[model samples]
Target: MQKDIELSGKLGKKRGNTKSKDCKTKTLILGCVVEKPATVGEIFKRTGFTGTYKSLAGMIRTYHDYGYLYRSGNKPFTYTISELGLEHLENPRLAREALIERRQANAVAVTRRFLLGMDEESRNNFLTEMGIQPVEQHVTIAKNEPAKPDKVTVKVLPEPVEKAKNEIKTNTRTEYVSRPEDLELIRELEEMLASVKEENENMARELAGRTIAKAENSTKKPPKVRNYDELLIRCKDTVVGSSFFNEVPYNLYVVIAELTKASMKELLKEKLDDVLGKKDFKKGRIVLVSDVQASALLRYKFVRKLKEEEYEKIKPKVEFRSDGVYIVVDRLHFADRMCDLPQIQRKSTPIIHHS
Candidate 1:
């Protein structure tokens, strides 16, 4: 009775295992087809199935025959899930469980090669870190085998020491130290500033002294008054307006000589007409005098007539003098004749007497 119970239990377990394997294979095929219509080769490759290609092709044909999947294309047959297959997967709870199992299986497969390349201890430690349990069978195999040298070695520093070394290097690079050369540069700059300050002060003092000296000199005496008679005598014998009035329309010299001989006040156009006894002579002379000789004759006449007190006031006003008509003449023409006449020099030198 005990032997029969044990035998029945073993058979039941074998049947249960076979059922689970069939169910997993069907689920993988359904998942691949539901995701996209694919050929037997694509489905097998994507699902990472361990079955032979021929077996997978046979399984795909079987599914199409059972109406669980439908053929979408021919040459190389492509299969997609049918309504019956979709209805089986429509159970939300079962679908979610299947998806989670598929993800876990993929993760295991992806890391399996890397884990196998590691030694037993390292493999266990890596699996532990990844929250996975290392297989006991793998551990037993590792124990039976001789230890092999590691293919790759990695160096890892403690966190605090690595951080401290980085900080020390950064601080050393950033820290600044003053040298003797810098001190020397600063000292030289200070000396230069001091010398510049001294030079500026000396220049300011010298300028101030010069300003005071000029003020004192200005107050001590006025400018020496020029002798107008001496000025006229120096310019005597030179023709008035000779440089600019080279070709006179009339006999300008004759008119000038007549004015000097008369010893009259400077002649206006009307006075010139009266003295020369002809209106035409006055009109012709006007062109010559107005063009070049007006300003010079006016200046001479102004000085000749100015009194001591009047000279000071009118000297500044002479440049702006507007209300006068004077006959232009060469002073040198009269100088020799006037030297013999005491009255003409006496009339011209009033400012000299006052000074």
Candidate 2:
């Protein structure tokens, strides 16, 4: 049984345990490495690993082989996270969620293997214990075989005999007495049943209360929309003289215009640079005309993938207009604010328009 349990990766062993291969162990190992490079002994102690020293060493070797860890030092080998491992640990929430999913899948697989190893009766009992009903096999009988009696019936007695039997039964019923122990047992059983019923009722009430609370939470109104103008002002102030402003690609403006309902002609006519050059623009004066443009800009400039921290930093600066378009009120203003016009000091040159 111990061997089987160990093979099944369900053993409660202190050393050389199969749990070292589990997602939780892997996560712990990565977390420890992220904190600082450590030797095998340090990692095991920090992570509270129950596996043998030899096993821990082997696991570290495996991690190094998989490009998740890099080994350093000779006498007392130290381990550090590789670039790939750092990427995995970059988002702790995603890593933890993935670990949870892996654990659930492993649990299901283990349960299936355990059930498959059990005998028929034991399997049935296991299913019943888990609140599941086992399927029963239907048996067929041959047409030539004699039918088995499920019940037995006796013929009626003669009238005189029947009358005497009825009189005896009536006398017995009239003189029947209940034993003290039997009565006490009946009372106890009734009390137990009542208690069970009350418990069930309490559980039902609790379940109902939770359901109602969940519904209320689901139906609650969303957070109030933030003022776009204020957000634009903040962005303009923060980014105007920042290094990130200079890094903004010139092609992004063309891309934004191409993605929006407004044409390049309209943008040029408005003197795009001048309109955004003003620092005292009124609140709600500028509206976004294209969601595609905003999304494209965000994807190109900020993050192409979902990361909560980066997303939050850029989210406040953009808004989705009711007209199904996304707009950045400060796009032109911020860009214009970044220009060092006085520093140029050169004669005005003819601007070349590239088609």
Clash pairs detected, candidate 2: 16-52, 276-333, 288-327, 290-326, 291-326
Per-prediction TM-score to the true structure, in the order listed: 0.22, 0.22
Off by over 4 Å in 2: 1-21, 90-355
Note the Cα lDDT for every prediction shown: 0.43, 0.45
lDDT of 1 by residue, 123-211 (tens): 76885686544333321112223333421122233357756675442232221223445446545644655564565568679989999
| Cα misplacement distance, residue 215 of candidate 2 (Å) | 59
lDDT score for residue 305 of model 2: 28
Candidate 1 residue 258 Cα shift, in angstroms, is 99
Candidate 1 all-Cα RMSD: 52.8
**Tens-digit lDDT track for model 2 on 189-244?**
44655564565568679999999988989977333221222333334423222222
